[model samples]
Target chain A: MERIPILRMGDVLLVSIQVDMHDRLAQTLQEELAERVVKDRARGVLIDISVLEIVDSFIGRLLGRIASISRILDAETVIVGMQPAVSITLVELGISLDGVRTALNVERGMELLASSISLRTQE
Target chain B: MGLESNSKLVEVLGEKGRVSLNDWKEAQWAAIKIRREPITEEELYREASDFMSLFQQAVKEAFLSDIRDPVWLKMREMLSALSISRARRGFTPTEMATFVLSFKQPLFEALKQAHGTDSGALLSDVWMTTVLLDKLGLYCVEEYQKTREAIISRQQKDLLELSTPVVQLWPGVLTLPLIGTLDSERTQLVMERLLQKIVDTGSQIAIIDITGVPTVDTLVAQHLMKTIAAAHLMGAECFLSGISPQIAQTVVHLGVKFGDIVTKATLADAFGLALKRIGLVVIKKSGE
Candidate 1:
């Protein structure tokens, strides 16, 4: 069974989806992400998908679902590395990813996650 | 109208082509009834003369049935060039087609005078000429339409680029003043341009000015939100300016929520907000 590796750094879980994900892989990643959020007590989840040039509605929904699951588990999720074409495609598909936080790249994603998590802690 | 080996239409036209060409030129020059004449009479005469000579040479080398033969290449080139110019000069498709069809009259008269008193032979010859000339006329119209489409598409691209101008007001601040309808195509263009500019300049703030936009419906609002969302993903804050009182009422009545987006009534207000966000302030001098 192929599984997406979830790397933990301090209080954050970093997942970079570098492979072309199928339905099964996306499902597995969603389950693993939810479980890791609770087990590791992660404060934030940063997902880098800049290499993902194509984003269908299914993958778009999966991102939104993961954001929701993380929010429920008391962790903030920030999606990063979205290509310009992918952004246009997602918008065209009417997938707003309303609850999902997005950053330009991993570096900016880290900054967004750190700032957002700090804001949450203060609240 | 079977002619001897040497009496092919091509040879006949070649031998007496100058006479046929004069009649064709007169007929063509007189048929310029278009309100907006694209070419002068002299220019038209020159083109007509050139085409007749080319046609005579083409037919001399190949049968009329083989319209795509290499011999007719020059004729086709002339027609294509004429079609494009006519399209540019605002000539309608019918008028452009007429330019080619008018040649048929002189060719028929020349053929009749050459093959006098042979009714059966004249009918067949005229029929062949009709088919050939009709094909050429249709080709001219087709080329004219193609050229018009190309011109229209180029102008549309120019308009899109003109409407979306991304100006860097400050080091980390960019402004896009939109002055037209926000359709899906233009929205996509705006998003790509704004995102690329953000990456190029590393600008963290973008102000989209819509004061010039006539109206904002639900769909337009959605496009605006999508653009702002994409910019947000890029770690840049997007501010929308130029919300008039009527537009504000329309937005609220339409139940469109901007959700944490900073909206201002004018570009100046948005600029001020952008400046404040970037921690830049301009104070009045002691004695301005």
Candidate 2:
């Protein structure tokens, strides 16, 4: 039962997926991320998937689901560091991952989350 | 008749070698002169002499009916090399075939001299000679065609590479100036190169300039959208630039949707937007 670790930086939760995600692992991650977001009172979720080589429609849907769940929890989700091949595959698979903000890398993702959070707080 | 004709052919080739080789060279010179092929006399002499020796050796050893026999491998290899070079030198298929077929006249003359007053033997020998030389001539033509095809495909690949060039417009912006029509294959290449460049340069904004593209139909629009979608997935915003009036009218008439992707009339406009997205602006110097 391997679990992907979710770390908290300030009010943001960072999940760097370094392993090939399976259905079970994705499901576990979804449950864990939801629980942690509520427990930590996080305002943003940044996911780094630079090491992920393959992604299918299921994983694409999972990303969309995670974004939706975070949005409902009053947090922003920014998926970052997606490989070129994976991005092309996702596009070809017709999964645009709508409603999920994305960035080139973790630093950009953090900036995106910070601005978005600041913008929301001001509103 | 098979083995006997082959032996007689070999014998004539060996006995009157000098006379027949000279006759063969004369016939080749006449053909080259008629075609105005830019082949030097010395080069022609050397190639014909080399071919004669190889042909004599192969005929002495191999089955006359089959040029593809392992014993005739040397002859085939020599002709392949000859045809490929001639093909590169702009020799037509007929000219290449004639280069081999011209040997027939000289060899037939030698056969007539050897089998004088023997019609039956002369007939079979001539038949064997025609079959062998025709097979070899055809082999040369085939090799010529193959060389031409190889050259054509190489140029095609070069054209594909040349047409799609992704350039960095700024530190965080890139532009792909696409030339030629967008087909599925070219689109795939453009997408791959643009995406790889995006990853390599870490550019957040990509502007695809389609000014050089001649037409915009539904299929082209679909391909452009796919590329934009792929870029979007990589977290880089793509701006479509260089939409002429005709292309815009055609796109609207065809009902092709670009969705939320930004479309600009010119690359300069797109560059301006891109620079703005990256928080940069060009201010003209008032003093100058």
Candidate 3:
């Protein structure tokens, strides 16, 4: 029953995966992320996975699914801090992770989320 | 089982080592008759002389069954060095192996003169020499192949790095001019380099100019799409340029949908558009 910690930064929910995630732990994170997106009334979600080096297709799909679910709850997800090798591996794996936003780091992720939220509000 | 044959080999070599060495040099000189530029006859004689002395010492102490033994280590080392040198000098594998195999004829001639009285001992010694020389000759071929493959793979890696270069045409604009076919492996390199460059420069626009890419088949298109998609996820806007009329027709006929990926016929046109996106305009000087 291990849970990945989700921190609340104002209107954004921050999830940082610091360990080598097993399949069950990743599944739990997906479900918990969706629930927290609803409970915290978050406008944006930023996931920091710079620590994740080995990203298989399953984990890639889970990220895409999280983005889809967050959009359903009116929240945007920005996956951040992907290592260079991981990006190459994911592209080779043919998992494009469509509809999931990304940034180089968490700071840029926050900027992107802020701009996206402002754009939505203005629209 | 090979101990008796080993001692007989040592005895034959010890008695006629000098005469055999001279005959071995003559055989080598004749074997390399086709080549004139890289290695001179004098250098060949020197190499053969050194190798003969080493071979005599090895016959005294080395095991014929296993070339990896410590006593045979120097002989193996010498052969590998010779093979690599010849490979670099553009000698074919057949020629390199001939250089090693030629030693067998002279050694066999000298062995017959020494063990002529005893047919059984002579046969055993001749058979042992054949096995030993065969191993050494095959080692030369293996080393030559390994050197050639190592050289080819290194050059290929260099070509891959040189072909895919991402240059910054403007402050916020980058251009990756691809000049060759886009396979999956090169596409992966392009993606990694483009993404890293995007992050480094904080550039928002990337122009992929594939003017030199000769074809736009489905696989190439798929690779391009993957690169573009990865760049998009990195928060950069990617566009395609250098699309000739032929490539355009092929892409259209193939029914490939490049949704919203601004395409241009030339890099100049793409640069103009990129500048416009970044709010920059080019103006000529007054009297140029």
| Top DockQ hit | 2
The clash number for model 2 is 0
**Cand. 3 Cα-lDDT:** 0.84
Clashing pairs in 3: none
True contacts kept of 1: 0.38
In what order do the candidates fall by TM-score, top score first? 2, 1, 3
Per-model chain B TM-scores are 0.87, 0.93, 0.91
State the iRMSD of every prediction, in order shown. Answer: 1.9, 1.0, 2.2
Which portions of model 2 miss their true places by more than 4 Å?
A: B5-7, B17-19, B34-36
For TM-score, candidate 1 versus 2, the one ahead is: 2
Candidate 3, DockQ score (0 to 1): 0.34
Every candidate's CA RMSD? 4.2, 1.8, 4.7
Give the range of the ten consecutive residues with the poorest summed lDDT in model 2 chain B: B1-10
Q: Give the winner by lDDT: 1 or 3.
A: 3
In model 3, which regions exceed 4 Å deviation?
A1-123, B1-12, B15-18, B117-121, B286-288
* Best of the candidates, lDDT: 2
TM-scores for all predictions: 0.78, 0.95, 0.76
